[model samples]
Every structure is written in C-alpha cells, then in structure tokens.
Target: MCRCIRLQALIGLLFLIFMVPEFKAKAQVETIASQRQLFVDDFLVDQLERAELEMHRPVDEGIAFNLDKLWEGKFSLYTTIIKDGGTYRAYYRGLPDVKEGNDRELTCYAESKDGINWYKPNLGIHEINGSKDNNVILVDNQLTHNFSPFLDTNPNAKKSERYKALAGKKVTGLYALTSADGIHWVKMQEEPVLKEGNLDSQNVSFWSSSENKYLVYFRTVDSGFRSVSRASSTDFNSWDQGVEMKYGPTPLEHLYTQQTSPYFRAPQVYLAIGGRFMPNKQVVSDEQAAIMGIDPNYYKACSDAFLMSSRGGNNYNRYFMESFIRPGIGLNNWVSRTNYPALNIVQTGDTEMSIYVNHDYAQTTAHLRRYSMRLDGFASLSAGYAGGEMLTKPFVFDGSALELNYSTSAAGEIFIELLDEKGNKIPGFSKEECQPIIGNELERTVYWNKNTDVSKLIGKPVRMKIYLKDADIYSFRFY
Candidate 1:
C-alpha cells in the first residue's frame, strides 16, 4: 500500500478508537431529563454539509497567486477569518516578499463584504515601519509576525486579554496584538509573549467552551517533523508551554501536513485540523529543493486535512479521518503543490464551515476557493462528546450570550431553550421546538426565526441549551 494510504488509515483508526463514541442508545431508550441537564430527542440533523469549493478572484480572470499582505514586503502565511462589524475581514500574514529578502517583511490588510471577492484595503492605515502606501504594518525583519487577530466584544475584559500573533523567522515566536476594536492593532510592548519556549508556535487559537488558548500543529526543528502543540494562557500574551499531540501525518513523512482553524457553529470550542502530504523534503528549504531534485514518478501527493478539540486550551486530542467514503482531489489543480492554505476557513453560520484559500497556477492573478462542509452527529454529542465529556467546567462568562447551532438528520420536530447560569429554562421564548429544513446542512446560524426575542438573553450569561435528542450541533459562539 502507498505510504499515504497507510498514514490515512492509521489516522482514521486513531480518531474512531479514542475520540468518537459508537454509542447504541436503543430506539426505546427513556429520555433522561435532569434539573441541571436537559434532553433533546435523538434526531440526526446534518448541521454542516461539506460543500465543494467555489473560487473567487481579486483579478478578473485566472488564478491570483500569492498570499495576502499582512505586512509590507511579506506574504500572508496564516490567516484568521474575521467578521468585523458588518464587513468581513481576512486578517493574515504579510510575510516578507522573498523577492525582496527578510529585512523588509511587513504586515498588510484586505477586506470583503461577502467572504469571496476580497479587496486589498486602501484605508491608508499606517504601519509600524513608517510605511504609508504599501499598507505595510511592520517592516522589520528581526521580528517577523503573523496571525494575531481575535474577536472579543468586551475590550477591557482581562480574561479576554491575550494578544496573539505568530512571530519570528522560521522560528515563529508567538506575540500579542492589542486592539480596542478588531482593527487598528498595537503590538504589545512587553512582547515575545510566548518566548522561544520548548515548542515552536506556528498558529494560535482558543476554544470558547473552555475559554482558553491553544497553538496549532507544529514541526520540531530538531526532528524536522510536524505535530500539534498544546498550551494554556489566561492572557494571550503568555503561555504555559505544553505537550505535543500525536496523531495524523507528519512533515517527516511524505508530504503529510495537518492544520487548525475555527469551526462555524457546532460549538464555540470546536476546532478543525487537516492532514496533507509533502513528498519532497526540499520544499522546506530556501530554494525549490525537491522540485529541482525529486523524480516525478515517485510520489502521488495530495493535501489532507483533519479536526481536533480543546475546552480550556491546555489539553487536546489528535484528530482522524473517519469517513467510510475515501477522500480524493475532486476539482481544480490550483491547490496542488501549494505550501500555505489559501484563505482562512470561516464559520458562516451554525455548523456551516468553509475554508477559503487561494492559488495561482500559470493563469491570471489568483482565484480563491472555499472548502465547505458540515458534521452530522455533533448535536447528539456534547462538547468533546466523542470523548463522552462536555465542557462541564462551569463557563465563567463576561455576560456574553452563548451562540448555538442546530440541525436535524431526518425531518423531525425539535425544541431549544435558553438556560440561565443556574440551569433553568428562561420563559417567553418558543416553548415548542421548531423544525428547519431536514437533512440539508445549516451554516453558522441559530433557529432565530422560531424565537423572536433572542435579544432578551443576549446581554446575560446563558447557554443556548439545545434539546434535540436527534439534532446535530455544528458549533456555538459565546461572547
């Protein structure tokens, strides 16, 4: 068997064995309703339906190759998909333009209303490097940074104070970017927030359920291998250096790569990572090392992706590809042999997720492609249900309403409720559950159509207590 097949099979088995529970709740099982606990019927709802990627281009025709500029003279290495106010913003790395060399790397900006059709922001926003036109934020090569924008309503909340962004050269040092709004950031003075500790910080994120910080899968320089690194932080600036999570593809193996980004609506704490293959070792080198040396007949390479979870950020589980139907490249060769994920994956609505990426072939500029999908069986499960555990760690809130996502497998009746911090259902909302379109996937949205007064619960600390015995939860968003 090919090494790719073997690696994939191993990952699949690992996820099924440890995380997902093959539960047999009998058809006639009694509904167990408790005071602190509530029950929804066992209805299967396709919350997230993986959709085929659609391409968007800044240029008129053909692919727009290259990353968005987060800094001047820099390429966008990692991106955080964010919806600022009404407009959608893809805040990404403005990695140094290699054609210009390291000394000139900087951060830049881009904006879009629809996730597609991005426009480079001409806000005339100034940068750290005294650049006014290039849209460059920082132009210094001594400290390279990327991926630090996070969404938080309460600017003064200390618990929500972790300033995050990837910095350093190949040695990505974790740093902090502080902003009153999601835009207009100021790099924290006491930076190197996460120093060159034991683990290399590649990409960073936090789970809402646990209200904690996390670092994405990484490769150790020593082994030249990649894997997930786990850590905890109250403030984004500092981290409790963590353990390396083991699962799925590794960089050392032939083209095996995995990554993490936010999931749309299932649970606020949900995160997805994927695995892909890197056939040639030289891709990591300065030049196109493998392309210049490797024989074409040797490797059948394709990018593979996966998913993982963390409540408070300190702990994590390795994800696996558990589909009975094997995954293969379906369309466009734009993503072929690519190094960075095009655009950041977005949580469109509850359970609806689409990872936006761009690729430039020998065509025009570059086109953007969205990889969308929904996970069924998420509702019947709780936070980390695969592990038979919910984020029961008493979510301490800054008075943010918990955004809930619900979907059904077969067309059936479903009811939901708002539970106070004390776990009692609030009054005046829809008492009877409402049914949305059955089976089809619903994106990052709640059944707000049913409950007209969703506002009453907005400013309070509450959880969108979903009572679908048979519904699937794609994700939840907590303020």
Candidate 2:
C-alpha cells in the first residue's frame, strides 16, 4: 500500500476504536472536566450557582431508582454505579439475611440503559450461594465475603487490562477485586490489602476527580463506638494510616457517639451532604430551651442534615455548616430521624446535578426519595464589572411574576433598576427595600413584587440590575 493510503486507513481505524460505547462513556467524564473553564460570568452568581439542578424526585420504579427494581426481593444498600458500554451497571449490598424471610448476606447486580430504568440480566453473569444461576453475581475467589464494591478503570501501563473494585468488610481488612469485564471479579490472593488502624472497612469509594487522589471512606469504631475513618490509596492496595474525621462538635459524654457515612458524592465544588445524629439529652427545662426548638436536653435530636466539608481535606475544621431546620418529605409518616441518610448523586448534563437521599419512613421502614437543586444556590454574589453590564438578557416572565433567585448573607437594602432598549435607565420605578431578615450571618432569598406591571416590560428588551453590597446571587428566574 502507498504511504498516503496507509495513513488514511490508520486514521479510519482509530476513529472506529473511539466510537465504541465503552470508550465514549469514559470520554464523557473527561469532556466535562475540560469544559470547566466555561463558568458563569457574573459576580452576583458565584461558582456554585453555575451548575443547574435538573429533575429530582423519589428513586422508585421510574427514572430515579432503576437499581432498586433489580434487588426488590433481596436485601440491598450502599448502591453505586459504573458506566459501561452505553449504560450504567450498578451493584448494591444484597444481604440475604436481611430479607424479611431469609437469613444470608449477598451482593446483587442491576443494569440500566440510562442509570434510571434498570433491567436484571439473566445472562448467567455469576452465581450466588451454592447455585450458579442465582441473580447475585460474585466473581471473587472464594477467600472472604465482600461488600461495598467500587468500580474504577485501571491506569497502570503494565496491568491496565483490569477494572478495579474496593470492597468493605466487617472484619478488619480491605480487599481488592479485579475484573476483565465489570461482571466477573477476582479477589487478590494477598486479600485484605490494608488493615493498619482499628478501622473496619465500612465503605470504599474512589474520588474520580483529578483534584484528589484515590480516597477510601471507611466506617470504623473508636473504643467500640461508631466513627468515620478516611484514608487514601495509590495502587488500590496500600493505604495511608486511617484517621477519624470529627463530624459534630465535641463528643457528648452520655449518648452514644453517632456514626457517619464514609462515602459522599459531591460535585466539582467543595461541598458535601451527609448525615449525623445527636443523642437527645433532655436536661434543661422546657421553657428555657423552647425558642431554639430543643427538648431541654443535652443532645436534642440530631440537628438538621449536616453539610460537612473542608477546602483542604486534611484540615477537618475549616468549615462546617449544619442546618437546624429540616426539609420535610410529606408522603409517609417517617418520624423525623436526624441521621441515617443515604447519598445518591447523579451528574446529568454539562452543569446539572441531582442528589437523592434515603431517609427513614417510619422507625423501621425507610423510603428512598430524591431532590434536585442547582449548584448555584450555594454561591455568593460579588461586585461585577463597573458601569453596569448586561450579564444575562432579560428573559420574559413565563408565569404570573418574575422571581429573582438570590442569596445574601446580610439583610440589607436592594436596588432593582430596569433599563430600556436604548440603555436609558428608568427612574422612580417600583422600588421596595426592607430589612426582613433576622440575622447577618445566613442565606435568604428575596422576591420581586409580583403586583408590578411586568407585562409592559415583557414586550421590550430590558435588563434588571441588582446592587448587593456583600451577598451572593445564585440565580434569577423571571417567571
């Protein structure tokens, strides 16, 4: 063949290789990271507000919880996914013993076309118990049982053909499982890779972002009490000395120290959602603590879901924001339990996020519900370009009124200016400013007066300018 023809053929083959579904799935994650430079260009909206929250609801038999359907009859928990082919393959804990009528622990599989609607494969993937036909798939060499299986592609040049998984165990060691394909896993002979500290491998997760090295979130007990342990791994085998990440304030003396989930799904930004419990210590008089909604006790019910994080993962005390007011789910009569929340997060588009939580329904029954919110809600607005610029075109109101979704730390004056097509500012327009906030150290939204004449502003080109001295505006919705 001629040199030119040979080069053309090589290019065509390369293109075919990249077109494969498995290769494309991995590229999507890289493509998202490369496009990170295209952030929202406004001081009013911080980096957190750039990502929009799309659809969110209960992860049931519909779009949210395809993984649940596959393990409906089995005991399952700690669900995680790995994108393979053109879809996602999810694995969850299938404790055979937890079934209402059964008493054995096993892991199960569920595959999804879009990570939403799942189908159980009768492909004879693997076997469970003594039967090779059972839906519970296990490829690990029969050395030790497994739980908390995490899937990650290998990067090593020598043994790059394997997919890696980190499994947790009640006993003290961490096991490494490798698979040629995601389905069949082979546990390493030198199993229980690391068990340095007294930490029990509660859960294992890999930090896929380039910002951090591989992280393992372990569930450990300190002095025979529940605690969270964190460690890092390079080869997925050896790990750093595990250390407990202090969740709540100084430990209480009486109530049991609450255990925290080791794994959390956070977007690119430095924010994570997880659970923590506070033992109710009804010690104070009811009248003395009624204002704060406390039970006059030391540990008055775990505070609202805690937002625990650190700009620097090593420094545990950098920032801890706890919510006192809880967001209610009104379907079932699940008595409000403070902790025991499951983190179910999924990244849909370029900058859209969804967070699903497994909250308790009743004392024993728990329901898996989901809620979606934009990352922008967490950002703060800052001073923008001088001489007032048009950051976003004035979108027409689709509803009865326009709602500006803004966040400010202080309760202060707000100036809303409407500009005409010719860059002329309107004067004496509807102006309303009030100090309706209770504190100077929190986030609150301000709404535009719905009774105004938004109809006249709809037909013409307009720009709404906001003046926030020291606040963050997550987003603006004209509805």
Candidate 3:
C-alpha cells in the first residue's frame, strides 16, 4: 500500500476492530454523546469513498505591516499577534542583523485596532542606539531570541498575570515572563521552567479548555529529523516530561518553527502553521538574490509554511503535506526564511481570518505579509464534476440538527445519508430523501423529506454518507 493509505489506516487504529455489534441487534445502545469535531486534520475520519483530503490554499491579502521603524529590522521573526479584548497586539524578535545580546535581538511590540492597520508605538522599554523612542519590549537579554507570549485564558488566572510568555535557548533553558497589561513584565522564576526540551523555535504554550491544563509544543529531534514534542502543566511553573510528536507513519521533515496554538473557536483543537525548512535547498542564484534585494546569506536555504493539527497530545496529524501558504509568483519569497508564518492566526473580517508571514527575510524589503482563508476552511473533502461520495466513521452526537460548511458550483449538489452503527442506511435518512444541497454557505442545515430534525439520533451511534458533485465540504458539526 502507498504511504497515504498506511497513514490513513493509522489514524483510527486504536478504535478499529473493537467488536462492534450489528446496528439492528444492538440499536439505541449508546448513552453518552460524543464531542463534535472540526475535521481539521482527519483525526476523526475513518474512511473515504472517492473523496480525499483536499488542501485549501490561502489567498494572499498583501502586506499588512512592514518593519520600517528605526528599531525593527529584517530579522524580526517569531512574530505573534493576538486579539486582546478590543485591541490587537503583535510581538516579535527585533534583530537588525545576525547579532545576539545588548539590544541586538530584542522583543518588539506593535498594536492594531482592527488587526490590519498596525502601528509601532514608542513604548521606551529599552534604550537602543542612544534613544528610548522605540517599540522595544525587552532588551540586553538573550531571552528575546524567540520570546513567545499568549493571553492567559484560565478563568482563575490572577489579573496581575494575565499575560504569559516563554523564551530562551538550548543552554539557558526557557524562562517564564508575566505581565498584567502586556506592557510591564516580570520573571515568574529565576530558573527555567522547561530545560530538557528544545527551545530553539517558538515554543508555544496555552491553556487547554478541554484538558484544563497548560500544554506546550517545543522543538525536538525525532529519528534524526527536525520534529516537535509536547507536554502539559497544571500551572505555568512545573510541567510534565513530554514525548516526541508523532505524525503517524508519514515521513518527517524539517519543521523550523512549529507555531502551534489553540484555535480560538475550537480550543480543544490545536492548529500549527510550521515552517518546512529545506537546509541547503538553495534555488535563488546570486544574480536573482541581488535583483530581489535579499541578503546574500539569506539565499543559502529555502522554506515555506505547512499546516498541522492536534487534539492535545504528542501526535500531530499532517493530513496535507502541500504548502498551506505557498511562496507564490515572486523571487523575494523564495529566499531563506522568507515564507515563515507568524505565531498566531486572528479573525480579520466577519467571514475571514488572516495569518501573517515574514516575507523577504534578511532583506531590505522585509515585511510582514498577510494571508486569508474562509473561516474553518483549512481542508475539505472535495469532489469534482464527475461526483463522488464519503462515509464517516460510526460515532454519536449531541445537537438536534446537522450543519455543513460547504460551497458548490451552480450545477453542483450535495446529499447526505444517515447510517446506523452497522453501516446500514437508515430509512427516511437516505440520499433519495435528502434534499439536494446547492449554493455556497458557511452554515447550512441538511434536510430530508422526513424533516431535518436529528434529535432522535443525538445519543446513538450513527454515521454520514455524503455524496458531492463539483462541491467542497469544508467542515461539519452536530451543533
């Protein structure tokens, strides 16, 4: 079998062959309801009928902000943006050159009201180049090498420690910093909180609403490849020993920065936009690099952004190996570390979300570029004009109705058939009775001739067989 088939089979390996009885013989046996899934990474999907994991490309929205300030430079990497209350804030490393310590690699800050128009204010936290009128947050310390921060979502979190961050490198380990208003900061402890795990990249941590613990994904070496590891903590101070992240049996590649974080809408699901690095994979010629105005050292390697996801564990499912946000139609983006994604994704419009990328890295034209995608439209089970079908694994749900986030061509349509636990099509819920779905919508209810209500199947083991023609089913949920 091909590697894709092997990887797909390993997805639900733990639950397979669990001696499930026939639906007619053991009907209405389920008691508790199963949790809803976003289908973000195919972690819950069991089978496919002709449909496959269709990768979605993010549309380029142009540069949202540029590092034109006096203090900012080409090496402003690991940038993080968060929607804090009514205001949006961005933080990143500000390194004018490949230097370390003494205001060389300082943590800088920026603010945006609508998350698009950004302004770097004079916070004056650090005195750089004989001036204090800059957006430097932390300076003269090695902690700014990759200072990563996030808002504390714990309900019982103290107001004084509303903002938390993790930083440091291989030798000194990771240091914890906290702030009440995200401006003034203090170290939680003098010593490192996590020392053994690698901290070379953006070692991100967040409060998992489902697990009720703080989870962190950091850099690591797995089978001699640049991989990731994960751990959890009850509090930010102490953490459990983590294990290397497993990407099923899929071939592991160099992930320069695993910018993993909890999706705001689905806290239980963690989304990662990692930089797939190709060391020594130089493509830009010396003349091409000069024409694009990129640094000479920046042309030694190449990289692009790839998507990954997890449900809070040591495993990250890479359902799609293709570039999530490709370096498109330009020579500047082909340079080293140019297409690396920032730390977080935020909702920029009513129906759109944006992810920032560091473009033209190590070049005079360095800037933070923007990419947008439809909400919950990362990957889809898509079918073409010839039409195809898909069957989900046997599971239970809680909501009274079924909703789909799908888009279809004018001549396209979608039909769903509800099946019992034994894979038998339930009467009145077959494709013949289901109304053909047409049009583009983010949320549309699926209906049948017997009525759209699915309250009867709320707590029972059921499945869905979806037929599609020239359409894309981005996601589905019981709620």
Q: Which stretches of candidate 1 lie over 4 Å from their true place?
A: 1-76, 95-101, 126-131, 142-145, 153-166, 170-172, 197-201, 211-224, 248-264, 281-304, 310-319, 322-339, 342-344, 347-352, 361-367, 374-479
Residue 47 error for model 1, in Å?
Answer: 21
Question: By TM-score, is 2 or 3 better?
Answer: 3
Q: Judged by lDDT, which candidate is best?
A: 3
| lDDT of predicted model 3 | 0.82
126-227, model 1: which lDDT tens digit per residue?
Answer: 544464555444444534344445554234454334333444534445556565545455567545565543332234554343243444333343255544
- Winner on lDDT between 1 and 3 is 3
Per-model CA lDDT versus the true structure: 0.41, 0.42, 0.82
lDDT winner between candidates 1 and 2: 2
**Candidate 2: 10-residue stretch with minimal lDDT:** 27-36
Score every model by TM-score.
0.53, 0.52, 0.90
**Alpha-carbon RMSD, each predicted model:** 13.3, 18.6, 6.7
What's the candidate order when arranged by decreasing lDDT? 3, 2, 1
Q: Which residue ranges in model 3 land beyond 4 Å of their true spot? A: 1-36, 98-103, 290-296
lDDT of 3 at 460: 77
Which structure is stronger by TM-score: 1 or 2? 1
